[model samples]
Target chain A: AQKVTQAQTEISVVEKEDVTLDCVYETRDTTYYLFWYKQPPSGELVFLIRRNSFDEQNEISGRYSWNFQKSTSSFNFTITASQVVDSAVYFCALSQWGAQKLVFGQGTRLTINP
Target chain B: EAGVTQFPSHSVIEKGQTVTLRCDPISGHDNLYWYRRVMGKEIKFLLHFVKESKQDESGMPNNRFLAERTGGTYSTLKVQPAELEDSGVYFCASSQVGVSSYEQYFGPGTRLTVT
Candidate 1:
């Protein structure tokens, strides 16, 4: 069975503070994909990032960065200078290669106070 | 380009009642997907459709649920005699034929409340 775990059920921080949401996954397949999605209060899920198991290079886009460490089976997301707009429920998901469906973790609700 | 779209932004029904949710995917996209997020739980895949054909329905909860994507344009999910435990947010997503699953564009979900 494939599983994705988001350890933080909720996190709150003042505006401009940095916050990291941790995700850990377990899968038997050697080739799989990990994803992060943000669902704002408006009720739409916005795709954040996608990282395959083969790629361990950390990625940075603007104030958002992701760390993927195969050694620990972890994919962590960090938001630098988080703003009120960043408040939302974030989800970590996993899927094996050629699999049609995603297995998601219990989402983490984030609150950013201005 | 238009993104995926789902109808009935919110729905409330009593137990044993029936409800149907609709979704319209992006133009020309051949892959459509259905997912659900129960309260306080994770979002999970309900099914997948390639055009009008059912590609996968392994995650479907039970027989009371039926999905149809006629003409390969839009899709509908019907729940009959919905139980209280069936209430949750139903999401629809779509991606191009050659695109990877990572590119599935999601629609604003339909929130279902069973009383």
Candidate 2:
């Protein structure tokens, strides 16, 4: 059974604050993929990042960074200096190598007040 | 290139009413997928299609839901008799073959309301 757990249901933070969203996954396959997506109030899912199992290197993009620690089965996302535009629901998902379907977590609703 | 597109941005129907949702995948992409998020819960996989061929549909809840991608261009999901539990956002996504990246492009989901 492949599952992704996002423990935080919601988080509220003031603008310019840093926030981290935790994601833990369970999968039997040795090779798999992890992804993060952001759904803004506008209702479109924006692709943020994707990490493969073999790549353990942490990724940083602009004000956003991801810490992938396969030892703990965790891939956490952090937003530095958050802004009101960063308010959205973030989702963590897992996928098998050949499988086309994505197993998504319950998602975390984030609100950044200006 | 146009992204994936779903018809009927919002729909309100009775519990026993039938509703059909359409999805047009990105051009030149062979992989199309259907997923749904019900009652603010986790988004779940419903099915996958590759060039009009049903690849995997293990996530489909029941027979009340029917999906088809004729000629492999546009797809449709029809609920013969929708249940109250079917109320949620239906999302459509597409990805290119051999992209090993496992990245999927999504559309602005369709919100279905069953009363």
Candidate 3:
């Protein structure tokens, strides 16, 4: 069984500030995929990023970045200069290779104050 | 391309009542999935279908939930004798292929409120 853990329940940050959400996953499979999704107030989930087990390289997309570490089984997401619109519930998910199921963490609610 | 769409954005029903939620996947999508999120809980997988055939349903909570996809098109999920614990937002997603990564598109979800 694959399990994802997100320790941060809620986080607050002022506009233009940076915030990092921590996520740890446990899986016996040697190869798996990691994903990040954001659910805004509208209740629609927006796909953020996807990383496979073989790729440990950190990724950056404009203000959004992700750090993937296989040793720690941690995949962290960071928002640099986050704006008010970035306030949403972020979830970290894991899926094994060739598996259609996605195991999601509890999610972390990020609130950006203007 | 239009994204996946779900019917009856919200449904309110009493216990033991039967409610059916509909999902129309993206045009040409071969894989469709059903997931639900209970209040204060993470979204959980209910089932997966490759066209009209059910590929996996291990995540289904009970037999009260019946899902079907006819003619390899749209799908329907019917809950019989709905319980209070069944109240939550049910989401439908579609992907072109099961092996494709990060290609699943989700619908707005149908909010089921069991009274």
Candidate 4:
């Protein structure tokens, strides 16, 4: 069974604070994909990042960064200098290579205070 | 390009009632998928469609749920005699078939409330 776990149910932080959202996954497949999606109050799920199993290199895009560690089975996301606009429900998902289905984690709701 | 879209942004129905939800995928996207997130639970896969054919239906909870993609352009998911437990946000996503990076584009989900 493939599963993504996001232990944090919710988190609150002041604007400009850096916050990290943790994600741990369990999968037997050696090659799989990990993803992060953001769901705003509007209810649209926006894709944030997708990382492949073979590539454990960390990624940084503007204020967003992702740390993929295969040894720990973790793919954590970090938002630096967060803004109020960053408030949303974030989901971590896992899928095996060539599988169209995604197994999602219970989302973590992050609230940024202005 | 327009993203995937789902109809009946929100629906409220009585238990045992029938409800139909529709999804229009982005143009040229051949792969469509359905997922649902029940309150307090992780989002789970419902089914998948490749054009007009069902690629995978293993995730469908029960026979009460039926999905159809007639012309391969739009799809419909119908729930007959819906149970209270069936209430959730139903999301539709689409991706191009054979794309190496199979990142699906999602729609604004339909919230179904069964009372």
Candidate 2 local lDDT, residue B66 = 99
Worst-scoring 10-residue span by lDDT in model 1 chain A: A93-102
Which ranges in model 4 have alpha carbons more than 4 Å from their true place? none
Query: Which residue pairs of candidate 1 clash?
Result: none
User: Top model by lDDT, which number?
Assistant: 4
Clashing pairs in 3: none
A3-113 per-residue lDDT for model 2 (tens digits): 999999999999999999999999999998999999998777788999989999999999999999999999999999999999999999999987868999999999999
Whole-model lDDT per candidate: 0.92, 0.94, 0.92, 0.95
Give lDDT: candidate 3, residue A31: 93
Worst 10-residue lDDT window, candidate 2 chain B: B95-104
Interface RMSD of each: 1.2, 1.3, 1.5, 1.2
Model 4 over residues B16-51: C-alpha lDDT tens digits? 999999999999999999999999999999999999
Models 1 onward score TM values of 0.97, 0.97, 0.97, 0.98
RMSD of each: 1.0, 1.0, 1.1, 0.8
Candidate 4, after superposition: displacement of residue A16 in Å?
0.4
lDDT per residue as tens, model 3, A1-114: 899999999999999999999999999999999999998987767788889899999999999999999999999999999999999999999987887778889999999999
Residue A85, model 4, lDDT: 99
Distance (Å) between predicted and true CA of B33, model 3?
0.6
Q: How do the residues B1-115 of candidate 1 rate in per-residue lDDT, one tens digit apiece?
A: 7778999999999999999999999898889999999998899999999999999999999999999999999999999989999999999998877536557778999999999
